[model samples]
Target: VTYSRSPASPPDGPAHWRPWRFRMSNDVWGTPVVAGDLLYVTSFEVHALDVATGRRQFKTKDVAWTMAVDGGLIHGSDGPTVYALDAAGGHERWRVQADAWVYSLKARRGTVVTGTRGGGVQGWEASNGEKLWEITGAQTDFETPESGPVIHGDTVYIWKDARLRALEARTGMERWSYPVGDAASCGGVPVRVCAAPDGHVYVVAGTRVLAVDIDAGMVRWHFEAPAVFLSAPAFAPGPAVTGGGVYLADYLGTVYALDATTGKDRWRIATESRQSIEPVLVTGGNVHVGSGSAVYTLDAVTGTPMWRFAAGGEVMGSPVVADGRVHFGSADHVLYTLDAAGGQLRWKLATGGEITGSPVARGGVVYACSKDRCVYALDAVKGTATGRAR
Candidate 1:
């Protein structure tokens, strides 16, 4: 079905319509990963589709709960097995068994890194699936590595044993480690990390956000919130550091803008919903975040609310900004496009199920996955379906 532009849309808004939908065999909860011309989605299986036509390029039964693509290779894991497949086709290159169930997978710089349940973090050779290094953590639930092996440049950052460790991505050499605090304080929620271009990595540890020196492996500063941070699988509302400021929201619905270098609060504002907020997206001197069923736009520096657009259901997925527009999905089984500056509803499309994954835009096309077990492609500006639905 085609979705035309909303009547309330501005005259300059692009014509919005659904171009095509590719059905999957199982429910899809992850965001569509765009690599070259192929769009990859993982459900109980992995399927690669032609980005323009929505035609199935290939499908594999590898069952990757988490997947990453780098250098023509698709790295993923299911249960205790980690595997790499050729991105051009769905052929398996190599598969290796991990000591525990793998929870996270990252592939970059000829290295495949996995964070496993109870097994800590391990690095493997991407070319051959050979084990290169393993850092064992405590076998307990609270002490195991929480999340990541988040690689930035030549360094990999991970939270294990209540501390953040930085390792060399290729050689598995220890660069440095910083103690963030007790893991139990986070109430069993996994801590996550994000690296910035300003030579610092931000981590959410319990109620505090730590800014660590990327090169020195030391905590530059930390900003503590009044409440614990809330996060979801693959959509952690971690800090967004850009242009000398770090923006984040707490579970209590308070958003803070802090000086990136000093960790001092520049401004803070509370949202209407006293619930968990989605990840913060800062761009063009504004902050975009999702809370409850609404997407809010605030001034990046002043924390002043600019506008809000309400959806039919909770906005669980984070929003992506492209070409002056914001793209996101909601539990109401819809994909929404809004003007980035003014928060006007350019268009909206209903899917068969909840859209908890964020939409991705590339080459003027937007791709989004739904719990309906399908991936839908639409024109970025016009929101029209690009190809025939399959």
Candidate 2:
């Protein structure tokens, strides 16, 4: 099919027509992280897509379960063997077998780190994938680690046995640990940590967000709400030092902007539904997030609803904002484009399956993945198409 470029919200027919380049039919667990010309997308398999063509430059499915990218290597864990592939190509540089499957990956200060279901955090060389260091904090502790570790400047953070621990990123040496609430295992899920531009760290556990000074490793402030957190917390654009507040969404779909310095609530808006995906972009004094079957733009400061765009299917993936446009995928098997300022429908492209992975947008192209076993690169301009359909 072919047609002239038209407005995103076509008064009559489709806005633009195109095809998908690759099909990857599986659940996408992580967001598509973009570096430069390459977009790292993971499913049961991890593939590198060219930013301009949406063509598969390489595919690494050795682990096929959990894959994470940091520095220049993509690490995958499938029970015993952890394969680290060169980010540019699918070439395997090194393989290591841990006590169990490595479930998550984190990067900091030229170091690539991962946590295993066996309750061990391992660091590897970012260039050669060699074992740099390994630290077994606790033996599974009756529950496997779930949340991915966060890397601060010189420290790495993890949740082991319901308590937060800070480790040396370069050597995996124990520096300090904080027992947050109780000792009982909250199913061994790692606490989500957000690093402020300042020297403080914010950790989310269940229903509370705690702030800890980097130097002191002590709680400076904390804010608690009725809602429970399941995703990582994100910070808005600001200087890190003044202890800026963090933005978080709960299981109850209530979004709160909290003061970073005091851990006090600045504003709260209830969405009346659960938001599984983390809020993506905070631009122009508004926040963009996918909630149920709609995408919302809220006042960054006041938490007021600015606009909303309805999708044909439920929105599971986070929105990708670039060049004044909001792009996201829906369970309805469509890629939606909307006006960032007015929330007007720009265009909709139909895929063969649900889109669970969040998209990455750069330059004039958008890269996205779907359960239909496909990766698509779309032209940023209206009435244009790129790639081929299956």
- Write one digit per residue (lDDT tens) for candidate 1, span 201-261: 8878778788888889888897778777764211112343433477778776777777876
RMSD of each: 4.7, 4.8
Deviating ranges (above 4 Å) for candidate 1: 1-18, 138-146, 231-243, 272-278, 385-388
True-structure RMSD for candidate 2: 4.8
lDDT over C-alpha atoms for residue 267 of model 1: 88
Per-model CA lDDT versus the true structure: 0.76, 0.69
Candidate 2 on 1-390: residue-level lDDT in tens?
A: 432333432233222423336555556555676776677777667878665445568877564566667767776767677777878877887777776676666666677777776667787776666787886754354343345666778788766655677878888787778886443433223356777777778777767788888767889997877866766777765632332357878766787888776777888887757556464356667777777788888887778888988888788668878888888889999888888999988877787788767776665556677777777766654524544553
Supply candidate 2's per-residue lDDT for 72.
73
Could you tell me which 10 consecutive residues in candidate 2 have the lowest summed lDDT? Answer: 9-18
Candidate 2: TM-score? 0.85
